[model samples]
Target: MKAALWYGKKDIRVEEIEEPKVIKGNVKIKVKWCGICGSDLHEYLGGPIFIPVGQPHPLTGNVAPVVLGHEFSGEVVEIGEGVTNIKVGDRVTVEPIVACGKCPACKEGKYNLCSLLGFHGLCGSGGGFAEYTVFAEDYVHKIPDSMSYEQAALIEPIAVAIHSIRMANFNTGDTAIVLGSGPIGLATIKCLKAAGASLVIVLQRKSIRQEYAKRAGADHVLDPNEVNIAEEVKKLTGGLGVNTAFETTGAKIGFDIGIDSLKYGGTMVITSIWEGEMNFNPNVLVFSEKKIVGTLAYRHEFPATIAQMSDGRIKSDGYITKKIALDDIVEEGFGTLTGPEKKKHVKILVTPDKSLLSD
Candidate 1:
């Protein structure tokens, strides 16, 4: 089997690797489609962020050179001993989260915040960037026949958007703003509209993503480079500011704008995985009685996200911009996504089987 493995910063190789075997209570999957995620890009650019290097991950006991694709969907090729309820040929998507059940957060049903939090693809346990991978049966969710493999692959990110919205608890008819027009930002825009937000604003710099933000149902798209974002948002909300704001861009400027574009009691949700620390004035929160909350990945939101996708609340037509073979992952997949032409793409899926690649 051929898998894309992370060696170190700027070093990802797609080479032949041993196929993962089925363990008791686990299921083997033949990967159909795997999307290159922002987190994966971070690892390739400035990491060891989540990829354990010197020592093994506490949960999966794997280290550097780990297989690296978490956003994936596949067909169940084989089922392991003691694995029930999931059958061979079932189309499914892996949740990919690695959490210790004994952790207080896990016991409280907030497994995304587990003290030993990790991801199957990032921490260890061979990931979905290959022809075949295995994971415990409990972590895989069956997708309806109506959903395509590409849409199934999107469930992970859509789940992320849905979870962030759920955390905000934004009321119907409330106004909201989403900072950044990346994949997660686009998903957040769609979810916000679907959840009955009366007004949804998007902040983006790239022309391609600005168009995507509109297509994703944003009521307004503002380019920070063109106007004062916080003031513009305030003007749109009748000078009261938005009821809620989501910061999906890890940039410090986006973070500051999101906080500043809030009502006296508004909530700002931080959804980006930042690479560095941020500096902001505490008086902003202290004076306004505002709240700033940070969210990790999804927590038990996959099923609802799939249902939303099936009902057309979230469209998958334009989200996927390109597809490539496993061998071309580094140059075509990662390079195209992070390079100068990055704005031209939204999501790029890679297949381990060359036969699956097409024009």
Candidate 2:
């Protein structure tokens, strides 16, 4: 079997590896497609953050230099003892978070915040970058027959968007702004529209991303460099300002703009993970009664996301900008995602099985 192994900063290698085997209560999947995520790029550039050195994961107990990739979908190849819900040839996408069900957060139904939560790609599960990976049966959800593998591969991120929108508590008539045009940001816009948002605006510097945002149902796409986004949003909303804003760019400037563009008493959902702290104005939030909320990964939304995809409601084709083989995992896959050429790229899917590659 072949897999993408993380060696260190800017050093992910594709090499031959032993195929994974099914364990009790787990199911082994033959990975078809895995998406290169922003966090994977972060780890590739400046890592050992979530991945520990000289030790195993605190929760999963799997160590560093493991197989990479988490956003993926595959076909079930084998099932371990006690796994009855899934069987061979079943297509599914995995929920990568393995949580300790006894934790307070898990007990409270907030498994994403489980005290002993461990993510598959990050902690020690050795994710879908490999030819085959095993996951708990409970973590794998069957995809509808109408959904393509690429669309199934996206359910994880869509669930993240769903959770973020739920955190915002957006109403049908609400006006909202999404401060990034990346996969998650654009997915947020799609979810916002599906939830009945009257107006959904997107702020992005890259023209390609802006165009993608428009195609993904953004009511208005603004280039921050070309126009005053805050002022334009104010005008569009008849001067009351947008009722909600999402800061998905993980940049100080994006954060500041999100705050400035919100209506009084509106909420801003920070979906991107920042590497460092940024200056935020406390007085503005205090005076306006505006709220800033943070969303982590998804919880219990995969089935609903799959349902949306099955019904052809959430179109993921516009977001998948590129597809590459496992052999080109370094150059054509991750390189196109994080390099200077990223301005034109959106979601890049990697296929371990070259037979599935499309023209």
Candidate 3:
């Protein structure tokens, strides 16, 4: 089996590795599609962010140079002992979160906040970037037959958007602003519309993402460079500003715009996995009595998110901009996504199986 391993910053090698075996209560999947995530790009550019180094990850016990790729969907090829509910041939998407059930967050059904929180792909347990990978059966959720593997690969990010909305307790009739129109940002826009938000404003720079923001149902798309985002948001919301703001861009400017675009008592959900620390005035929040909450990853929203997509509330059309074989992941997948022409792409799905490439 060939898998892409993260050596360090700016170094990812796709090498022939031993295929993972099925463990007790686990299942082995033949990966069909895996999207190169923004987080993966983060690690490639300035990492060891989620990739455990000298010290092993408390959960997966594996360290750096491990196989990567988590946002994926595949067919169940084999099952381990005690895995009864899932069986061979089930089409599925994995949640990919590795958590300790004993932690306070886990005990409270908030597993995404597990004290030693880690991810299956990023933390090195097993990843979807290879031809075959194994994981605890519980982390895999079945997808509807109506959905394509390419679309199912999007469930992971879509679940992220849904969870952020739930964290905000966003009201249907309320207005919200999404800062950034990247993969997660685009998903946030679609999820907000599906949640019945009356007004969804988008803050995007000059890129193809601006077009995606509108297609995802943003009521107003504002170029941060061309317009005063805060003032425009105020005017759109009748001087009160939006009821919620989703910070999907980890950039400082996006953070600033999100904070400034909120109304008094408005909630801002930070969904991006930031590359570095941010400096800001606490007085801003104190003055407006506003709230800024952070969302790590999806918890129990996987199933519901699939149902939403199945029912047509959320669609994956137009999200995937490119597809490449695992051999081309570093250049064609990661490079194209972060290079000079990055604006030309939104989501790029990589496949270990070449047969699917014909599509």
Candidate 4:
């Protein structure tokens, strides 16, 4: 079997590797498609951040220089002992987060905050970049026959969006302003709309992304370079601002813009993972009674997102911009996804199994 291995900055290699064996209470999946995520790009550019220099993962205990990929879906090739819910030949998507159920956070039903929580790709456990990945049965969710593998690969990210929206707790008919037009931002738009948001205003700089956001169901798409986002949002809401704002660009300017676009007493959810701190005005938040909330990786939304995709409530086709074989993972997939062509690329799904790639 062949897998994409990460060593250090800009070092990704596709090499032959031993296939994983099914273990007790674990299922072995033949990876069909995996999406290149923003976090993966971050690690590729300058990392060993999540995977420390010489120390192993606190939970998984695997060291750095591991297989890299998590946003994926596959077909079960073998099932381990006592796993009765899923079986061979079943299509599935993994939730990725393997948490210690005994932790205080887990006990409180907040598994995302588990003290010993770890994920496959980031922690060195063989991940979806490989031909086959083995995982505990509890992390797998069955995908309906109606859902395509590319779409199934996206459930992980969609679940992230769903979780962020769930954190906001927006009421039906609340207006939302999303400060980015990347895959997650577009997914946020879809999630907000499905959550019954009356209007969604998307702020983006790139024309391609702005067009893509509108196609993904944003009520209004504005280019921040062309117009003042806060003023436009205020005009849209008749001098008031959006009830909810999502900051997904991970840019300091985007954060400021999102904050300025929020109505008094409104909620702002920071969904992007920023590596460094940025300056924000404390007085504005204090005076307006506005709240800023942060959302981490998802908890318990995979199956729900898959169900939504199967029922046509959320369409993944518009976001799946490219598909390539495992052999072409580095150049055609990762390169195009992170390079100057990023705006043109949304979700690039890589398939270890070519038969399933087209399916």
Sorted on TM-score, highest at the top, how do the candidates line up?
3, 1, 2, 4
Best of the two (2, 3) by lDDT: 3
Give lDDT tens digits, candidate 3, residues 194-227.
Answer: 9999999999987778889999898889997899
- lDDT against the true structure, per candidate, is 0.91, 0.88, 0.92, 0.87
Worst 10 residues of 4 by lDDT: 44-53
lDDT of 2 by residue, 1-359 (tens): 99998888888999998888899999999999999988788789878766656877777777767888899999998999999899999999999997989989999999999887777877877788889999999989999888888888888888889999888888888889999988899889889888889999999985688788998899999888899999999999999889899988989878888999999999999999887778766998999999999999899888888888788677776888888899999999878877778978878899999989854
Q: Residue 264 of candidate 1: its Cα lDDT?
A: 93
Model 3 alpha-carbon drift over 4 Å, by segment = none
Pairwise TM-score winner, candidates 1 and 4? 1
On the 0 to 100 scale, the lDDT of residue 41 in model 2 is 82
Query: At residue 174, what lDDT does model 2 achieve?
Result: 87
Residues 52-99, model 4: lDDT tens digits: 448877777777678889999999999999999999999999988868
Model 1, range 258-359, lDDT digits (tens) per residue? Answer: 988999999999999888887888999999999999888999998888888998977777899998888899999999988998997889998887777752
Model with the higher TM-score, candidate 3 or 4: 3
Pairs clashing in candidate 2?
none
In model 1, the Cα lDDT at residue 357 comes to 71
Candidate 2 structure, TM-score to reference = 0.97
Local lDDT at 24 for model 2: 98
